[model samples]
Target chain A: MSILKKLPSKARLEQVKKLSSEIFGSTWNPNNIRNGSKILRAPLKGPELVNYYGVNDSMPTFQDFKKWFPELKLVDPREAYRVKMVEDRKKRNKGAPKKKKE
Target chain B: MPFRFPVKFDIPKHAYVNARVLRDQFKRIQYADNEVTRNALRYLARNTELPAKVRLEAQLQLTSMPKYTSYSQIKNRCVATGHARSVISDFKLNRTAFRERARAGLIPGVTKASW
Candidate 1:
């Protein structure tokens, strides 16, 4: 069974959202709200989340998530943010021109 | 009886496709370069299945020195020999050579020790 399937639901989401707001220094938007809810409903395995979310291998743990959302069982946003940043950088590089051939 | 009107969001199909493509390509490139920026490009390339030439071009253009190297070392290497571009080209041709050269500090502004 998928790890995400085993996670807590509704109540957990509320807690996580509250935490996300504090850590991100911004209010949660629809997209992240949906994502955060999904994460709470079924917390994906680290690697699976990385693959699906385009996160890095070095992402944070459930404990870190707890620190952020003390109430919900989740992974740390800091780790998630790190992976997201890596993914973002790759996208930025795609349009750049190749180096001049010697 | 109910009359239904379809609602369309402003987000374009190209934007979604582009983002997906970008992420996949970044994933592929990440294995090669392993930096956040490089990895993201790899993810995009892999997802889009961009032509190999285009992907290679992106890799070449975006490649940079590892963080540990000093600016002076990079400048000196450039003046001493036009090896930076060559090393990157070599990396494209032969993966093993790329690794070796990267280890030997042949690529300007990067060192295996740092990696």
Candidate 2:
């Protein structure tokens, strides 16, 4: 299954869609298929399953928009921070000692 | 995110940042939650005629993971105010906060409805 090979014709596309429908029934999310040289997209499916079973063993993924666009830098603040939970507790409860001194 | 008590802060910036961190923490552990149940179910569903004792053990393991880890535990709250109950998806704010902001023209292209 050389999935990298482009099937650029209506006859080739129906063949792939038929094959994929047989393989993955419910979980087969499809793709937006395009027509050649016209700014047009035909409603279609089986691209995801084609990529999944044909190219990749696992599921296909959404394209990484952050890599494509410089402005959208995704960051999880948890990576950039430490809360010091024990210190926060001590400061919050300074009047009443958290632990008894021996 | 719902595991942590809604953080109340005098400053909106502190509250929003704290909530964001908690939400990210929730995302981190979510895989573990799904993995525990998924593996257990797979053992039951895919395996053929496993010993009753082993199946029971798998069920027990699935039940043992914290209730907090369940998908139901994650909640959307207003990032600005930490209001939990009625947060709307579009602006991520509870109705009260959304109304205030929309009325004040803080949220672009949204206007309060009058009947």
Scored by TM-score, the top model is 2
For model 2, residues A57-82, the per-residue Cα lDDT tens digits are 23322234435565777553554343
lDDT of 1 by residue, B1-115 (tens): 2322122112212212243333332332333333444444444344334666776666564455343221122211111222324434323323445576678878677665543
Across residues A1-102, which tens digit of lDDT does each residue of candidate 1 receive? Answer: 676867689778878987988897755553432222321333222333113223333565455557878667676578799888877877988444667888
List DockQ for all candidates.
Answer: 0.02, 0.03
Alpha carbon lDDT at B74, candidate 1: 20
lDDT of each residue in B3-72, candidate 2, tens digit only: 3533321222223445453553344245333544544453563333566676667667656765544545
Clashes per candidate (backbone, < 3 Å)? 30, 0
Model 2: share of native contacts present? 0.00
- Cα deviation at A49, candidate 1, in Å, is 33
Taken over the whole model, the C-alpha lDDT of each candidate is: 0.43, 0.51
Most accurate candidate by DockQ:
2
